[model samples]
Target: MNPASHGLKITEQDGVSRIDFVERNILDEANIQQIGESIGAVVDASPRPRLLICFENVEHLSSAALGALITVNTKVKARDGQLRLSNIRPQILEVFRITRLDRLFVIHGTAEEAMDTFG
Candidate 1:
C-alpha cells in the first residue's frame, strides 16, 4: 500500500512493514498526526505486525512527533506486534535518550539489524 500522501514510503518483506520518512524534518503537528494514523493503519492490518521505522532521511523531529511515535508503539503492542526504529541520526538519538525513549524502544543502528531482530 502506498501512503505517499502521508509523506512516508512503505514496503513490506518477510512480514516486516518498513516505513521511511520522506521529509527531513518532522516538526509539523499535522504531518505527525497523519504519519501516526498511517502507521496505525499498518499495525491494525496485521494480527502480529513487525514494523520498522527508519529515520535515515529525518534530521529533526518535534516532541509531537515523538508523541505520535509513542501512540504508534502503543497500538503495535496492543495488537501483540513488534516495532523497531532504526537509522536514527545522532541528534535525534540524543533526544530519544534525553526523554528516556531509548529504553522504551527497541532501536538499532541499521534497518538490517532491526530486521534481524524480528522473530
Candidate 2:
C-alpha cells in the first residue's frame, strides 16, 4: 500500500515488508500520526505482514511519535505479525531504553538485519 504521506516509504521483497520512515525528525504531532496511519495501512494491505520499520533518517522522535510506535506495535501484534525497528539514533535509542520500550521491540543495527528476522 502507498503511504498517505511522504514521511514514509514502503517496500516489499522476499516476503519481507519494510517501511522506512523518511522524515529527518518525527517531532510534529501530525506527522507522527501520519506515520502511524501509514504503517497501519501497509499492514492491513499485506496478506501476512512481517514489518521492519527503518528509522535511519530520523534524528529525533517526539513523545507523540513514541506513542504512535507503540500503537502500531499493538496493531502488528493483533494481526499476528512481527514488527522490528532499525537504524535508530543514539539519542532516540536512549529514549526507548528509558521508556523500557527497547525490551518491547526488537531493534537492529540495520533494516537488512531486521528484515532477516522475518526469515
Candidate 3:
C-alpha cells in the first residue's frame, strides 16, 4: 500500500525498501499517524524487509512522530527485518540521541550508505 501522505515517497529496488520524508517537519498528530500506518503497511508488505527511512528533508520531528518510529521499528524487528534511518538533520538527530533511539536504529549519513549496509 502507498503512503497516504504525499510528503512520503516509498520506493523499492534490488530488495531494498526506502521511505523518504519529503516534508521538512512532522509536527501534526494526524500526519504522524498516517506516516506510522504507511510504514506499518510497508513493513508488512516487504519481502526482504530491509527498510530505510531517509530524513534528508526533515528538519523537525515531534514526539508523536518519534513514537511512531519506535512502533515501526518494533514491528520491523518482530518480523526479523532490518530498519535503518539516513540523512537526519543534526538538530533532529539530537532528539534520537536524547531519547536513546540512536542506539536502537542503524543510522547512516546517506541513503546509499544505509542501502549498502543491507547487503
Candidate 4:
C-alpha cells in the first residue's frame, strides 16, 4: 500500500495565521484535522480576532476541507475573529458558490488584498 499526505506550511503574521499548502489538496482526514487544530490552536492561544489566509494551492477542494473551514470560520466568528481566504481558483469558486460558503466567508483575490483589507 502507498500513502500520500498533502503539504502544508503555517505561519503567523500581524495577529493572523497564514496557511500555505505545500502540496496539492486531497482533503484527507489528516489534513482536515490539522487545519482544524491550527485554527483551534490560534484561537486557544488568543481568542482575539484573527484573519486566516489560505493560499489556494489546489484548483479543486474537497468537501472535508470546506467543512473544516466552515467549522473554523464559525469558531472564529464566535470569538469575534474573521477567516479570510485568498488565491481561489475559478473552479473552486464555483464549489464555494455551490456550498454557499462564498457568502459566509471572506474570499480575497490575493494575499495583498487580504492584508490591505485590515490595514
Candidate 5:
C-alpha cells in the first residue's frame, strides 16, 4: 500500500515493515486517526507483523497521538506481532518516559538499531 498517501512513508525488508511519519507534528486528531488506521492496516496484512515506526520527522505529538500508538501496540500484540519505535527526539522521549510508555514499548536510537532487534 502507498502509506504516503495517508501521511506515512513505508518500506519493507526481510519481512519487516518500517513506517516513517511524513509530518513533523502529530498533533491533529484527524491526522492521528489516519495514522492509526494506516499502521493498523499494515499490522493486519501480516500474519506475524514486524513493524518499526520511526519518529525522525516528528517534533511534537499530542496525548491523543500517544493513545493512537497504544492502540496500535495493542493490535500488534493481539496478533503476536512485534512493534518497535525509533528515532524519537529527546523531548518526545521525555514525554514517553513521563507517561511510562517507554517501558511499554521497545524503543531504539535509530531505525537500523531497531531493525537489528527485529530478528
Candidate 6:
C-alpha cells in the first residue's frame, strides 16, 4: 500500500526519524521488508548520533515490524548510536510489553517527550 494514500508521513526531526504509519495490514513479509528497507536507507544516508522511530498512526505492529526495529537497533548500536521508539499505540505497546521489547526499546508517549529525554 502506498503510504501517502493513507496519510502516512515519514520524516526526520533533529536526526530522529518519525514514521507516521497509517493503519494497514503490515503482516506480510513484503510490507515488512519495505518498511525496513526504507528506514535502513535513511540510516545509511545519515551521520546522526541516533535513530528514533515515532510511531504515530500505527495501531498494530506485526512481528516483522518488531524484527525490523531490532535490526535497526543493532545497526545503530554498531555505529555507536541508539535506536529509539515513541508514540506507540496502547495495543501495540501491549505486544512490546508481552515480548519484552518495551524494556528493549526506549519508548515514550510522544515524540516531543522522547526528544526531550534523548536530549
Q: For each candidate, what TM-score against the reference?
A: 0.96, 0.91, 0.92, 0.83, 0.95, 0.82
Candidate closer to the true structure by TM-score (higher is better), 1 or 4: 1
User: What digit string (tens of lDDT, one per residue) describes model 5 on residues 53-95?
Assistant: 9999999999999999999999999999999999999999999
Lowest summed lDDT window (length 10), candidate 3? 1-10
Question: Cα deviation of 116 in candidate 6 (Å)?
Answer: 1.2
Identify the superior model by TM-score, candidate 1 or candidate 6: 1
lDDT of every model, 2 decimals: 0.93, 0.83, 0.86, 0.72, 0.93, 0.72
Ranking by TM-score: 1, 5, 3, 2, 4, 6
Quick one: best TM-score, which candidate?
A: 1
Predicted structure 5: lDDT:
0.93
- Residue clash pairs of candidate 5: none
Model 3, span 58-97: residue lDDT tens: 9888989999999999999888899989999889889999
TM-score of 3: 0.92
Task: Write candidate 6's Cα lDDT for 3-109 as tens digits.
Answer: 42233356667767666665444566776777777677666666754666777767667898799788877776676666778888788889999999888788888
The Cα error of candidate 2 at residue 89, in Å, is 1.7
Better of 1 and 5 by TM-score: 1
- Residue lDDT tens for model 1, 1-119: 36543899989889899999999999999889899899888898899989999999999999999999999999989989999999998999999999999999999999999999999
Q: Which residue pairs of candidate 4 clash?
A: none
Note the clash tally of each candidate.
0, 0, 0, 0, 0, 0
Model 2 CA lDDT for position 23: 72
| Residue 39, model 1: Cα distance from true site in angstroms | 0.4
